[model samples]
Target: VRATQNAKSKMAEVMPDVPKKLDDWKAAADTLDQGGQIVSLYHQLAIFTRPSEATTAEENAKVIWRGRGFELNNDTYMHRQALMACLPMTLSEKLHNDMRRMRRVSRKTVANAIHLAPVIGEWRGTATPTLILAGRRGQLMTLDLYDNDQGNFNGAIIGTPGSGKSVWMNEIAWSYRATNAQVRLLDLGRSFEKLCSKANGQFIEFGPHSPINVNPFTVVDDIDRDMAMLTPVIAKMASLSAPLEEVQYKAINAGILRVWRAHGKDMTITALRDLFKTGTLEDLEIHNDVRIKDLAIMLEPYTRNGQYARFFDGRANIDFSNDFMVIENEELKRAPDLHAVVNMILLYQITQDMYLSRERGDHRKKLLMIDELMQQLGEIGADDPVKARVVEEAARRARKYGGSLITATQAADDYYSSKQMETAFQFADWVFLLRQKKESLELLDRSGRIVMDDAKKRLLTSLRTEPGVYSEIYIYSPMGEGIARLILDPHTLLLFSNRHEDNQAIDQRRARGLSIDQAIDEVLRERSGKPS
Candidate 1:
């Protein structure tokens, strides 16, 4: 009010026509007094030239500024104070002293003062970051794959072959284990053999020769929930061509109820298959159902005297009692017909383990890492969607049960190409993208669904890997994002190596009465040309 009165007095005395200017001044002063949205803008202008061409550089700089409609100001008078004011991390005392002599805010502040600079996108991850990673600036940082505030724990890892994807996964699994979390890795490639050995974890090679009593028929306290989960596995076994109708699922459920009523704890695929011999689908109220009978016949291979009887007919013999268990099935690729079927069996069994209660009632933090997520997803058929739904539900609710899912694939086509895989892996809150094909990267750019800033896009496109030394990866995470290097020492690199030669060397030493650790040390000694 005092300023308004003084402005009126001045205007009436000698500047009657300048009242409009006074009004503008009054509005700005009022905004300042009211503490509105006034932000300080900082801009950095870099001028590079040879010492001898300094004069010419100044003239060129002035011309460039003028061309951009910016008036040039010679800072020779207080250059040090002006430059220091623009620099971050400077002391506030020095900043206040430097800025006190600077020009006041004007209409030109927003019009010309804000230009992009080398800003810091530093993210100090979660309070307890599980993994240690180095940022683009070589600053040590931490990474937490799961944060409860985000309410997500699922992760996705994608990369090209030999791009250190295995090493990256080894780091994550190792990091999680360091926190005492229970880890189950479904690795078909045997990539984590050495890491599993080093961790003293079970590296069970699952195959036709190795028998695992994975009974997907075991009852839980909640029979309805158990049926909801078990029905899909049976439906997939009987029908894999297309999606089964609701009636077919109901018939399968009804049949399970009858079998469980009679078999009790002896419920095996063989028993279930045998139930249809004397019993009709009508006994279970599923009349006129040739599909249910056909389903039983289709499961004959899993019954007694059937081809898969030895593997599927037994009770629970496999133990995931250990904290870290790696179930490697290298023979999966050799059997093309049972690829989808086998994947479904292994995944559902693991899901059961995740949901089951222990005798000690200790709920260890459970984590399932699927190394070939896309390939597993690829096994899913168009009409046969039970596999996809199974995976989706498992991942969607894993976080609620003190568990998480981690998936890795070679390309986007590994998951995106299959609708089944897409739905299953889409909830990934943390993603690692190593060097990939341009086409795959395009799909990764949210397929144009979510807009990516140009800076992030450039960083992603610039990703490159120097295998064995370091792998450059862009982390798209719910916590934060940055390009980091997964650099391991020689020991860790050997332990997580997926190299065939390394495996052969380890095997050769083991055949000569050496333990896995002894074999690794011997191999490393041989490579270093040191005597034992």
Candidate 2:
């Protein structure tokens, strides 16, 4: 009786609303007694009482069954399965104390028996839905992104270079494409070529010599939103500071809007730059205070005959009608400034396209997968309101448009090294931590998606990478968290492998004028000892 009062006092002290929760549970019980429908109290209790790590499996099993108020006699042996099965529900008087000892405790939705049964052994519930092999324990575990409730369909994968990050990205992209979802990738390392080809995807190479040029002014579907998107780039370019920077930003925004309006379909970066050079912008409220000449001088480099004149100056040479599009940025690796701008433009374009597609009543799934996302988003401050809004708006694209944005990086430092990186990762609903550097683990721990206790840390460090097979990965999401080895079949392995010879062979096949699908079939025949 004393212990019960003490427990109640502790609960009251820790949770001021304890009485409310208990009353709600009591009301639920009363309803059940009166043959009313079962109710959810939104309160949950999970008990983790493990035996000593050094103990044998048999010893651990024995200890779990008979310890702490459990009475299992010699004649009535408790099967391990039965004991484990009852673990979720058996109410022990001593367990309350253990629950109080834990921290960061919050109320979890208390699901009734029928609704909770399938969630016990697997992540899915009731009917077997479309299952994509996300990872495997003893057998393949599947997850359906379309389910919406299990997760938000957003994902972030971070790991060291050789830790199979690309492999997993390839698998997930291909899996979605196989399910008939429109998939796209912003390829950083010239990877995903073979896989892109296999899916009959358009592989676009953006380089100085490449015919592709993206003019953000004309390309942007919505001028107001695009003006906001261009603000960061303009701010970064002018190297503006304080009052002058603010004045220039407004002038340049008004100038672009005016040029885009006047030129309409003919508007390009070159024309926009020319307008800033000589055009008057009396329409803008701040036109009298700002110097249009300074803004034009800042924008000259992106205009005709300037250093970046070749990019975003001419007409857009590429088409977005294809279901699968892979934009390879291998050539722009050394040009960080141009790379960042182009990335923003592409992201905006994709977002616009997705919104337009949805507006046209096409609700098919779309994805924007970015490799080396940290390099693309640049160093955004955690508190910088403008950049913060940009990241938040990017996250909202998932709901507004029926598409998901996924990013993969080599280190958590790349995404958490700055405030901007911090905000970017925070918006993600799913995280996959592959084999990472010891230093990176600290950042991951701070991510708050997965607990970084000694046991979990040990589990993360124990992950191994093997050839021709998937590496071990720790996946965490709002639904749950676990360690599983990423699984892939032989055909997918061939398509997504990073082997040099295989890629060269695929290139050779493409050179022979074979369609990507035909090339894939031929390569499969060569691998199988069958006639092509």
Q: TM-score: which candidate is best?
A: 1
List pairs with backbone clashes in candidate 1.
Answer: 242-383, 242-384, 243-383, 374-414
In model 2, what are the clashing residue pairs, if there are any? 380-420, 382-419
Q: Model 2, range 1-532, lDDT digits (tens) per residue?
A: 3333544786678765766666666666666677767522212322345566523654555576566444433313424423433465753444433433533123333344455343444333113234444444464566545555654677788978778888888877877787778888998877798887677889998766786777665566777866666665555444422224566667767777787788875677677667666645677644433377666777777777888877767776568888889999877767666766677677767777788888888888888888888666543333344445555566577656878878888988877665555666776777888898877887678766567898778778887777667677777777666666766676666677777877777778889998766666788889889976
Instruction: Estimate TM-scores for all models.
Output: 0.79, 0.71
- Candidate with the greatest lDDT versus the true structure: 1
Q: Tell me how candidate 1 scores on lDDT.
A: 0.72
- lDDT (Cα atoms) of all candidates against the true structure: 0.72, 0.68
Tens-digit per-residue lDDT, 1-532, candidate 1: 6546756685556866456666766666666677644345444454557899988998888898898687766666766765665566663665664464564223522222333333566655566678887876786777776564665888888888988888899999998998888888988788887788778899887566777655676534455666656777777766666666676677678778787877765788887776555436765575546666666787787777776676667675668678898987667666543556666666766766777744346586678998887555435465336766777777865766667888898986676766567765577777788888877877767764224777666667788888667888887766677788888887777778888998899889889988877888888899999998
Which parts of model 1 have CA positions greater than 4 angstroms off? 1-118, 219-221, 277-279, 287-289, 358-360, 377-383, 446-450, 515-518, 521-532
In terms of TM-score, how similar is model 1 to the real structure? 0.79
